[model samples]
Target chain A: MARPSDTKTRIQAVARELFMEQGVQNTSLKQISDRLGITKPALYYHFESREALVRSILQPLLDDLDTFTATLAPGDARRLLEDCFELMWRHREVLVMLLHDPGTMLGLDLVERVWEWRKRLTALLLGPSPSAAARIHATVAIGGMSDCVVEHASLPFEEVRAAAVAAALAALQS
Target chain B: MARPSDTKTRIQAVARELFMEQGVQNTSLKQISDRLGITKPALYYHFESREALVRSILQPLLDDLDTFTATLAPGDARRLLEDCFELMWRHREVLVMLLHDPGTMLGLDLVERVWEWRKRLTALLLGPSPSAAARIHATVAIGGMSDCVVEHASLPFEEVRAAAVAAALAALQS
Candidate 1:
């Protein structure tokens, strides 16, 4: 006897568990509903499609990213990289789900959103009248931080997060 | 009038041009043939599908990657980074085509190959008894270099290359 308000959260949880287990590409909405003991229609009522479901699942991370980018100010590269890495590390599961089947990511509109977000982050990191090479360094710094956590998920969080931030700062300095 | 052997090369070149000028997703095989003033069947004789055509166009880059990775030796990070940066620079067009329509990159089998290649490279870069943080640093170092050139293509080759190599060395030292 689940309440209506909690049903959406429940669905998001089950969908992520299933996506992580069998991969995003292989898991169907029907499978998710079946596991939750709800009808497929019930699932569709909450999420129109897999894209919508993935988006809803990742909305919090996107919101955090949007919030950080909105409040972004000129700062030392290390401080900025630390905040960005923490934001992503907080959403580690989303990155894990994506690492399982990355192709599924491109299908979601979030890719475009993240790309735009990266551009904004890049611009912020670029600072005043930066050289062309400096811009590349800043972009590389940003892109690499997000990627390392996913690629080395088996690594200790504290260890990898620090490493990613260090690497980003290194790129930014270059 | 291309010779039968060179038709493949010509198709690959025109396909890349159309893919770059338009986009990999938007440009059709017919458009490539239309631009080349050749019949669809004639084009088909060279490439059965857009996937095959993209593979053909990027084969040289992939082959170079394979060659370098195959002959990978235990070397200083700067030397390894320089070789990798140069290889990517030489195949700049392929990266440009991909950056234009990144979503299309997932549709090709090359994505899987590239992922696997990344794993192999990460392993090679991870020196003996590496810490989890060290592993993350190495992988970040490797990924950032490839992405920087593509993301900041307008940057001078010498400058970006130097920055990327320097950034990579900084990461490796971490």
Candidate 2:
């Protein structure tokens, strides 16, 4: 029999493909199971629900983000911008899912989860206490990149990456 | 007796108040009715559900957005930014509502609605056929403003207004 870890990796791979094609809201467990050539029970044993599966897929990205932001200082704006775009672009589809509503309402406190992450990133970029305007610029700088990444998802990777990083820096400097 | 229109207006006001204070997902129709000293059925008589009521509250803002975007050209970024901020800030609570998931998942197609508006706004800013980078910058510029407004919700309105506008312009220019 295939290892349980192998089965788990296959599930994540198939689920990400289906989700990227049809959106997180539209994909179902049955679809994932069918595509994986596994039964519903097997899928259930792996993931409690679609939300659980989604969180599993996303947790690593969040961890990488946490690692990157953990030691970031205010002067690291360009590095932060470039690194964030790289991290986000790698998981652009999931980033799009989080940016939208149905995927966020997937019962895992995805909303609060993302918001807290944003707050942490914002504080890291602006320091402990930022002025209202400084706060807004940082907010805009970081918040602006995801949707731009989504909108330009079809463009060449390097093209989208450059634009998003440059635009984020401009927002910070503004 | 208070007029029917007055009751509808009062319901909208109270619902908005409750939604802004807590959040759309947490605010129930019953709570809105109780706050207005009306029955739930009376509330239902005017609107079908929380989603319907939210639609009623946000429609004008969308309408105004459509109106403003309806007549514009490229190089209209400044006027567009200023006018859009005015419209959005006045309805900032509802803006937060749409930005959020629970409020959006209230059975409204708000995700689609706002997305269509964004496409139109992006098109106007970048012309009908902007390059890939131009598209991303336009997406970043306009998309950048809403969260900045939300973050600085407490500061004097003018400060947020100036900062948001400047940040948006910087994004576009970048």
How far residue A88's Cα lies from its native spot in candidate 1, in Å, is 2.2
Candidate 2: where are CA atoms >4 Å away?
A1-43, A48-51, A71-75, A102-124, A127-129, B5-42, B48-51, B73-76, B102-116
At residue A141, candidate 1 shows an lDDT of 78
lDDT of model 2, residue A135 = 78
Model 1 alpha-carbon miss at residue B32, Å: 5.9
lDDT of 1 by residue, B1-89 (tens): 54556767788778888776655656777898888889788987776776777777777877877777678777766877788788888
lDDT of 1 by residue, A65-93 (tens): 67876887877767778888887778878
Error of 2 at B76 (Å): 4.5
Local accuracy by lDDT, each model = 0.75, 0.75
Error of 2 at B30 (Å): 5.9
* Each model's DockQ score: 0.33, 0.41
The model with the greatest DockQ is 2
Itemize residue pairs with steric clashes in candidate 2.
none
